[model samples]
Target: MITARYHREIPQRYRLEAGKCKKCGFIAFPHRLVCPKCKSQDFETIRLSDEGKILTFTIVRVASDKFSKQTPFAVGIVELKEGVKLTTQIADVDVDKLEIGQKVKIVFRKIQEDGKAGILCYGYKAVLI
Candidate 1:
């Protein structure tokens, strides 16, 4: 049963979500609504591993309005062990020392704000392994 208001995003943000295309071998991270490569409507939900490697990252010196208090936080794309590349905030890390190809593991953490009245959003975030 879907438990989130944003059910479409629940698989990706709240769980170790992944997508497998029925027509091709392309796998998508963040659980696409449709396969970008094949435009396939059929997909299988896969839970990814907690481990991954840092593909790239940057420090959010100028964070968004919702993330203003979290400015200068480290964020990056991590290619998980399942080969699904995902964008997530890098936690348990010092922003100044982060580097590419660093080993990481997934953890559930406070990901973002929900305006003034909404669920305190929680999602998968990566921490140094």
Candidate 2:
């Protein structure tokens, strides 16, 4: 279910669709209305590669208010081959085993919940391949 206030975060969950500027080779993750590199409105929708390299990471000892029960999770920025970097949760890895340049893949997952009566949110998370 969609659980974000911003519409841009929608594609960040279901599909890795992004916008590549026709004027320049700038890829925008979660997509862009205009190219930041060349200020071009002309763009092509591109699906990002599932594979990427972990650029940096951090273990969340103190989780968010929504994800408090899910503490000790890992989060990181991954650099795709398309030159787009995405920040997402790094799952299925020991918190003590995290390091820079770790190879990972984007996977669909449950991110958080609104409440007991609310929607079970979902999004793309990274898993060690």
Candidate 3:
């Protein structure tokens, strides 16, 4: 069964939709009921930019069971052109050559599976530009 949280996050996971606070121009990924900056309740739905630059990164040589098959993957904090920062797996590149400030573009990809016959979860991953 899909949890409400998972259902609620489909927009962010699939389309990178965020909420822009009307009062202070703050963008919240996965949105929020209240603006974290200005404590305002008003917001406007916005789509985040797909392009970004890696601020920092690390090679995950050891990963959990769910991701062990994809070990030695790179994960990074990417700051989108709109200035919203998010942690995402960096894919389709050599981990050793990854550097801070490297340009990347977000893409939809399979994230993981829940069980033997479980649902396949999908989400955004960054690829070198």
- TM-score versus the correct structure, for each prediction: 0.85, 0.91, 0.95
- Best candidate, TM-score: 3
Instruction: For candidate 1, write residues 1-129 as lDDT tens digits.
Output: 223566657777778778788789678876677889989888887778889999999998997688998888999999988788888999878899999999999999988767776667788899998
RMSD of each: 3.0, 2.0, 1.2
Output the lDDT of residue 1, model 3: 28
| Residue 119 accuracy (lDDT) in model 1 | 61
Clashing pairs in 1: none
Q: Per-residue lDDT tens digits of candidate 3, residues 1-129?
A: 275766777899999999999999999987999998999999999999999999999999999988898998999999999999999999999889999989999999988877777777889999999
Q: Once superposed on the true structure, which residue ranges of model 3 sit more than 4 Å away at CA?
A: 1-4
Tens-place lDDT digits, model 2, residues 16-115 = 8888888887888767798887899998888899999999999989976888999989999999877789899999999899899989998998888778
TM-score of 2: 0.91
Q: 2 or 3: which has the higher lDDT?
A: 3
User: Which ranges of candidate 2 are over 4 A from the true structure?
Assistant: 1-9
